[model samples]
Target: MEGMTDAPESQKRALRAELRERRRIRTASEREREGTALTQHLIDLTSDLGARSIAAYLSLPEEPGTRDFVEWACENGIRVLIPVSRADGLLDWAPYDGSDEDEDLLGMPTPTSELLGPIAINSVDLIVVPAASVDRTGMRLGWGRGYFDKTLGSMENCPPVYAVIFDDELVDSVPSERHDQRVDGVVTPSGIVAF
Candidate 1:
């Protein structure tokens, strides 16, 4: 993990807003192409890592798309687990069966399948997460929520944790704190960056 952040929370928030706005203005065709490239990269990562079961998330409309990858994993007999946000500032893991889903308390997409304990993620071979931005050193700036931070921080022998973002979101630096967890690498439309 990276050291204590050189940037403050306010700085982080401002950057997140700018990034989100940039994503919001992308043309539909652009997003589709990026999502396709992103799906291939994710599939390559899983294949390279030889993962049998993985933890991943459903992408939001403006985020780098993981939906296609998640669905593909389900169809390929890969045991996929998705996150369910809990009121306690932690996450619950649920088996992703390619079933209709529900949004969590935070309005993020979540599975309605049978829920597992938080540590259920421990068994997965890999964990793919969402991020607003990630720095060159692997420090991730999540979207204002500590959910991924807490989940990753609490892991015992956590697998290779990778964040999904657009290629440009890979920047020189991002505002991070002591609580922020650095990822093993990141997957983007252009390719994967293993930090």
Candidate 2:
């Protein structure tokens, strides 16, 4: 991750608030267009990498949506695993059936199917995570929760992990700590960028 954070937790909170507001102000059409482009970029990347199984997240309203990409992956015989947040800050995985019928946890949609436990991430070839922002150095700023940080750290030999964000969310720097696992790359509407 980025060497000791230049900003404190309070600054991180302020940045998150500003980014969330900007995301919330976007029109539905703009979000849809960006989501579509993002899906295409991801599809191309996965195809290039020959990935069969991917661990992904169900995006929130203000975050770049992944439902379309998840459905497309399933239709094309790619296994898609989604996360279910646990009270202890760990993630439980479940196969995505391309259904929007899910419950909200901490304001984000989660699968209600039989959980496959957190280790399920170990079997996936790639991981697609949600991030509020990421730095050029690959440090990810999550929604103040350490779920992904914990999950990624626990993986045996974790596959290539990627964070999905909007075009503007990819920046020059973000506050990150030692425990925060850095991603291999980021996927935005414009294209994918690796650190």
Candidate 3:
């Protein structure tokens, strides 16, 4: 029964590999179309939550794109805080510059502004995070990196956290552990659902 309850690490690795392959094969046009829809989903969500300040990410080409939503937030006068990678494997925050030119080494687009430090995440009204996959229980599987995990765990007065992923990335279950923080909801190209 214990074996049936949680997937082994091997199973999770295999699922990650499969999903990576799928993302690799997806075309740019397809990703753009999906991004457009996802932008709307995020917009509606921000409205319903009355989020004036949002913590979100700049996506890679393969990930569910959040550039549109980030730009929208900036245009609409919503304070947008993006992450900067830190040497300690934690993330620091910076305001989005609403530019198409800035990016970090990992191909993750970033802002070229003064970093507001890690604790700045606590000030946001909502969080939109990237995920390799998320289960029905809102368990997010990251790329074996504990950055988001640490971020979510450290917040004392945390806001609602949502994992942003492509449509098929939301699955039945993902391997879970004591340190893995669950999200409040998920945002896909199709729609949104809270866990």
C-alpha RMSD for every candidate: 3.0, 3.0, 2.8
- Candidate 3: global Cα-lDDT? 0.88
Which segments of model 2 are wrong by more than 4 Å? 1-7
lDDT of 2 by residue, 27-104 (tens): 999998999999999898889889999999877777898878888888999998988888888888898878655764
Q: In candidate 2, how many Å is residue 38 off?
A: 0.7
- As for candidate 3, its clashing pairs are none
- The residue-by-residue lDDT of candidate 3 on 16-127, one tens digit each, is 8988999999998998899899999999999999999999998887888898898899999999999887778889888885974466545566788887889999999999
How does model 1 fare in lDDT? 0.93
Ranking by TM-score: 1, 2, 3
How does each model score on lDDT? 0.93, 0.87, 0.88
Provide the lowest-lDDT 10-residue window in model 1: 1-10
Tens-place lDDT per residue, model 1, 1-195, is 133343477799899899999999999999999999999999999999999999999998989999999999999999999999999999999999899899999898988889998999999999999999999999999988899999999987999999999988999988777899999999999999999
Model 3 regions lying over 4 Å from their true place = 1-7, 105-107
